[model samples]
Target: MRRFLIDAIVYVRDLALGFSRGWSRFFFLPADPTPLGLIRALVGVLGFWSLFVIGLDLHDYLGSQGWSDAAGAYDAMPPFGWSLWFYVPDSLLRVAWLASLAVFASMAVGLFSRTTSILAWIVIVSTVRRIPIALFGFDQILSTMALYVAVSGASGRAVSLDRLLKRWREARRNAAVVRPKGARKVSPDGPGRPEPSVGANIGLRLLQLHLAFIYGMAGLAKLRGPSWWTGMALWGTMNAGEFAWLDFTWLAAWPMVLNLLTHGSLALEIVYPILIWFRLTRPLMIAGAVALHLGIAVMSPGLAEFGVAMIVANVAFVSGTWLRSLVAGRDDEQPALRVLYDGACPRCRASMALATAADPDRVVEPIDLTAIDVKTIHPSLTAEACLRSMHVVSRSGKVESGYDAVTRIGSRLPLFRPLALLGRLPGVVQAGRVAYNRIASSRPRDAVCTDETCGIHPPVSVTGAASRTRDSSAI
Candidate 1:
């Protein structure tokens, strides 16, 4: 009995440790910021749209003469309801509304993203609170998106003017420094990738979980209604005077089709909160969500933005790794280019790792010339020449070597685009060639591994990622 108790304690201890690790990984793992940036852009655009419509009839909507005056709006406030419109005098209503529009526009394009994101949330929530009479599903979802986007602080990391300016600043800093002899040139995790952040993960996970909760609650609410079960709830929506766009009344002729759609959608919503958490089922659930939201938009054109806003909220489920590659014009199965390097050379392996580590963007495929036949990768790449400098091969069978190869890579990476542009200046390319040649020629190789088959690189595993051995002849 004592032995059994000891074993039980050890099992419990192991289970607890495993659960803690999983919890940390789910909430704190460093993630790419691209998806957060996308969500910000979508929310900003919707916020701008919301403000623009209000701005056109500022006095009629938000001013003293509006549907819901400041007095009533303030009186109707929920416990913590706050809105700047209440403080702004009627004389400055238009000015305040226009300023709110500008804030959303700036947030959309990611200008002063850190400051603008916070301002955007305030603007959205304030406006929504001020117009309680006109509020709907759109206001609710839009404000929710703004809240999380503001919290993330990672929305400007990609596809933003801020990113462009940052790259320029980095380029300027690099220009002031000169490389010493034998110094290698490469970005630690590929130039195109932004740094991973725990903050980004926190924001994205919150948004994802919140959206799941919403769908679960919505499904439960629908279950309380009789129309949803009879599959006639859709028919009611089809004939609704305020929401229906066209004559979906024809769906009445096919009762079975209506049943399929209504029941399927309801079932999907009910299962989404659970299934969306699983890796294998995530894609199906997300796709279903896209269909459901798009269907709502099509059926009720009046509430199109609300449908779109909810669909955009679902964007949080997207894998950061996949989003990064998609932005770089590649996917896991297809890399943009293959780079041949001498694995036996310490400088070469380290430089290659820097240029394409962790397979960021899935853009660069590093082929060790020592491990595989050079001809298999590219007819132009000979082991003798690859030993001297790295070579890049395009899918169309074009090949570039040395300085040309490095810059060719830069052309595909957005972070390196600014440098690529500067390299186009008449003397810049020539000067860069000289510098690259100097670095390449001085790169140190392994002391014992002198030839193509030095076998210095053992096929060791990294981060539990299986080291896939390539069939040299297969390529």
Candidate 2:
């Protein structure tokens, strides 16, 4: 009896420990700022759209002479919540509205990001409170994102004007340093770029937890409905003229497919909240979520924004590195392309692996700049330039660098061709180039040779340099 009691206590202790560890890791682990930055940028755009829609009928929505007069706005407020919009006079309401637009603009560009984010949150929540009748799922999502954006430092990362200003400052500082022509100067610890922090983790964890709660509660609510158990929930949603954009009632002719979709959706919602926390099940859960959300967006009219917001929220749960390497289609077994990479850089190595994985036909000859005879293979290939950026040589003896190299390689890969096509668009091409440069700049410069020794000092012999200049003139 004593042994049984002791065993039970031990089991309880182990369970408690596991729970604590999971919570700690969820709320405290350092998260890459890339996902957070991407989320911030998306939410900012969505926020701007919401504000624009409000701007279209600003006076009708908030003017005292219109539907919700100041007194009526105050009356519409929840019991405990307050709205400053009620206190502002009718004459100043327009001014307040304009101010809110300015705040949203600043938030979108990430100017004074944290402060503007907080101000934007307050403005949005106050607006929602004052005009509760105008609220929709989109407004709720915008408000929720604002809350997290206010708390997070996501705006300081890539894709923001804030980051641009930071890079400019770094450039000015580096110019002042007396480093060698080819060497890099490290930024001072504190004032340099801020490292990932627990706050980022907390913000992402909150988003993930909230999504789990949303799915779990939605699934439970559906379970209470007879339609869900009978596999007619989706059918009802489709047949509802007000909710559906497409006439999926035609699907009634395919009862088995309808049943599969209905039961599948319910099962997915119920399973996602539990299984998503497990590493092995995370990809499956994420895939299910993407499919479910995309289906909703494509099939439902008014709910498209809501579906998009959920997908954006899901971005926080995925690895930013994986997303950066995304290829859209299945791989086609093609002949190998000669790929040049900075083998010493872990990110470069990982990228190479991602691009080459699952393709048996492609032979990847990774040419380490430090170990390669630049003169022998491509007499015009300069080691210094290659080290500074990525390079790829096609079988036809054509060379590509930076964004061109990346896109060319991706175009040959089935999974990345679609993105490659998108990358070629006029405005998108410039943006893609800038983003690629940022990633390339982040690679470590203190790269070691294949022998694991400090790489050979630069300035290859005069003859090699001249040969490179002569052979690479076309590029």
Q: Which candidate leads in lDDT?
A: 1
Q: Residue by residue across 1-475, what tens digits does model 2's lDDT show?
A: 9999999999999999999998888788887665676677777767777777777887787776567776777876778887777777778977887787788888777677778778888887888888888787778877887788778755445345675565444433432233333222222212212346677777777888887888898898999999888888888888888888778878989888888998999999999899988999998888898899888887786788778888888887887555443422212312345677664444565455455442212433445554565555566777766776788876667777888888877786554678889988899889988998877765443323321232234321122221221211110
TM-score of each: 0.70, 0.68
lDDT at 72, model 2? 70
Model 2, TM vs. native: 0.68
Candidate 2 local lDDT, residue 278? 91
lDDT of 1 by residue, 1-475 (tens): 9999999999999999999998899889987787888888888899999888777788877887688877888999999889888889899887887788888888888788878999999998888888878888999989888888889888887556576556544433332222343222222322656777887888898899899999999999999989899987777877797888788878879998888888998999999999999999999999999999898899898788998999899989997667766546655445788888755444565556544532335577777675677998877767768766779998778898887888777776665657767886789889988987777665544333344533223222222111222211111
* CA displacement after TM-score superposition, residue 344 of candidate 1 (Å): 31
